[model samples]
Target: MPERVSRQLVYLVYGGKVEYHQEAKYSILSALHHAQGACPRILLYTDEPAQFIGWPVDVITLDDQILRAWTGPATYLHRRKAAAIRDALQYAEQSIFIDTDTFFLASPVKLFERLAKAPWLVDEIEGVWKEYEGDELHTVLAPYLAEQHGIDQRMLLINSGVLGFQGDASQLMDETLNLIDIMHPMVPKIHIIEQFAVSVAARHLGRPAESRGVIKHYFSGKNYWRHMVAAFFLRHGESFSAQAIEAVREVPTDKPRPVWWHRLNFRLRSVFLSSRMRSHAKLAYYATVLCADPYAKACGQGYAQELRRKAIPEGESLSIQPWSRVLTRQQKQRLAKLLGESATGHIP
Candidate 1:
């Protein structure tokens, strides 16, 4: 049979952070491997070019204008994501934006297929009321809804973390950027930057958005708290109560699976085995050695370990250690020279 035509392209926005980047690469590779022929190409938008060398996907750099305006750590991430979407609009048939922190547990082609029936934004939680339970949450959104959007106080807030846009849709890019520009002054509350703006724009445009299958906000909820406690036990071992791990482990994975928890557990396992233990060795040694790689063959990439081995060269210095050990005085001087500043003036 002929290969299925790829109707959607996915992009992940990332900074140069080691852990997130490694996970991002793994996410993309895993997505591609599992969704083979289901997704055409996966693009990574990053400031660091060295990170994408051996990956099967394409890597694009953020333009200087976007980089300079990258006011907050991951706040810049959304801007880069919007820019990449606009860029991809020129070539792709359809597109979706996923955060670097996300992992694809199943083929997301159904998401793209849904867009053909209607142009919509993916809903995170059920509705606005569910998103805001009380005054505390309402206060955070008052400024955007009352002042900028002129909407009733009861509107639902949508998350922009995982979004799909139809390529043929008109002004989608323009409207998205305009919303971002409007939210620029609200930098202190940058955590809600993209979501608030996107929610407002969808309301204003009267555009309908859909939720991807069984989505869960991993960072929230009692179940997540339990999993976090379990991860802590896995990383901290006997230092953390074994009861917590057993409690979480016994919580019955047989229940309906949560979308985001699978990814979160995958990440916790990766860091627990890799670097989290190295930093707090005493707390983690027993646990790290005891736990199996939860994500070992979970990613669907038969060659995840092999790909990592090739991408990260043998003996390549890591940035996690102290500055002195990673770089020599002359090397620091050379870096300063390239940055066009004195070595002493630069902050480590």
Candidate 2:
């Protein structure tokens, strides 16, 4: 008999309001399901345990203080996610850290395999450093990074949304955390926190030796929004986005499965629909669906009460593109009904 090959484990770290619990659960589940043959174990780390449903997978909870120590409010819940990755180093031989907002279009196991063949794998967002006027943020954070953390200015600009690392590489994790610690105090921009940490580490640590490692940064264009939509459908099902429901309904089941990026575009359409502020009725319905449970409760009844205040008068047709035109007839119907219900004040 042939010996079974060991499977690589993947970890997803997230911390945020419980209202997004369903979204987070669905995102991980979709990745697990889609990458069934690729990853062996999938672990989730969070700050609030109550937000998650029971699962056979491993779950680790941490205190807010530990989270704050690594990342401040600038990144909000994402700060805790970074801290979770640091904690995950004690276990597993290799792991991939994914943000909850990300959805898998296909098995990313090959990406890891590719990374294993290379040195490192990280993602780079479009126009990251270009936004920084001069290197003020980079320069100010550089000294603290070098003097205290030993990272250079050039390396302080990578995104941490998706990171692949060898489980045995504890040194990399330590260097990453140290950089996070040094940069956190000097930089207040929460969005750049994770990227800044990774960039610095990569630059300071030097590309891992061919035997040590290589780093490949993945870049995606505006099309990435489509992945978010696909993730929303897999999680919220028919509840969250009417457009996603329509898109899924229209897909030919026999056709080769849609790529992750295409599904992402479907989801992006929903976001665009929800943003049509002119459709007060549609806006209220989407808000009710998107708000999740406690989030709505927390905002009280007034959260969406104003939706009807500026509702488009009955019988007045809005100029927005209809879901049916964008998707199949069946999908269009489902979405139209949901939108109609929302406009009619039946959602709450």
Candidate 3:
């Protein structure tokens, strides 16, 4: 086997939110967990460096001016990701920038190995451009893209949740930034334009590889994961230690999947409820029934409350009476029992 090249695991955490910084910390811990004694140089580029005071990583402090400049003329937020990758390249032979929402399932050495062959690592190939031509993302700009950027059926639509490349791929990052600048204003509503740029630019180099097997990006189920991450910090505190690293293994790496009976029960009970209420019902189900584990149940309860808050109209007093009105007497009692309520009236 060829000797491995020096690599750095890079993360970008701005906005100075505690939740987001904590999420990035979990991801970093997961990498360290799977490092198996071969940990890379971990680099964190953030506006708030104080959040990771005790963490074993290089903190590249980013100020507002640099962030604004990286955003460029279009003021596209995601443009910073490309620019961040470009800056991180100077620190190592290969830079693997993983989003804060991701967790490692395998040793990151596998990621570097893939980069050795493919040179680019993206979250996943969602589909070809033609498959989504008529979707909300492309409805406004498909024709223009086809004419201007040669976007077609063969053009890949990639998820940029985990983006990586070697130092030699600086030109690819530059082209990605150029594509972002050119496309952002025209397709501002298309949130993944930066991802599209990465896909297209890397396509020009060669087919970019997917990293799903090595890491899990919970972008689709972000709220659930966020609640779980927050609960983790609340439980163990934010300090990074050997004990904290061991504690990370106790947090569930994936959300619990609802069983067939649980799904059927939720559908039957919530059929009469409005779409908004039914959504909360699923969360309630996860909290009370599916997530018997203490940590996940805590997250599920948080999600249930969050959904319930959103369901209420503005200026109205928050109460469970509205949620209970749609339920039959027997159904209310049943739901109350399932949710561990002492009485049917307590169903909330």
Clash count for each candidate, listed in order shown = 5, 16, 0
Better of 2 and 3 by lDDT: 3
* lDDT, residue 62, candidate 2: 53
Q: Can you write out model 3's per-residue Cα lDDT over 149-257, one digit (the tens) per residue?
A: 7766687778888878743878888988998898888777777888888877776655777797889898887767887888787888899988777787888877865
Looking at model 2, residue 308 earns an lDDT score of: 32
lDDT of 2 at 217: 20
Candidate lDDT values, in order = 0.47, 0.47, 0.76
All candidates in order of TM-score, best leading: 3, 1, 2
Any runs in candidate 1 off by more than 4 Å, and if so which? 1-6, 63-65, 69-77, 129-148, 167-170, 204-348
Q: Name the top lDDT candidate.
A: 3
Q: Give the runs in model 3 whose Cα sits over 4 Å from its true position.
A: 1-5, 136-140, 257-280, 315-348
Q: lDDT tens string, model 2, 1-348?
A: 111233333344444643245435544554555565354566666666555545435666657666666564444444455566666655656666665544455455655675576456554433333356466675565455457655432342456666666435567667656656556667666456665666655553334212112211212311222333334444446243334323433321121223466445456655545445424433333333332332222221232333333443554332243322234444334334433644543211
**Candidate 1 vs candidate 3, lDDT winner:** 3
Which candidate gets the maximum TM-score versus the true structure? 3
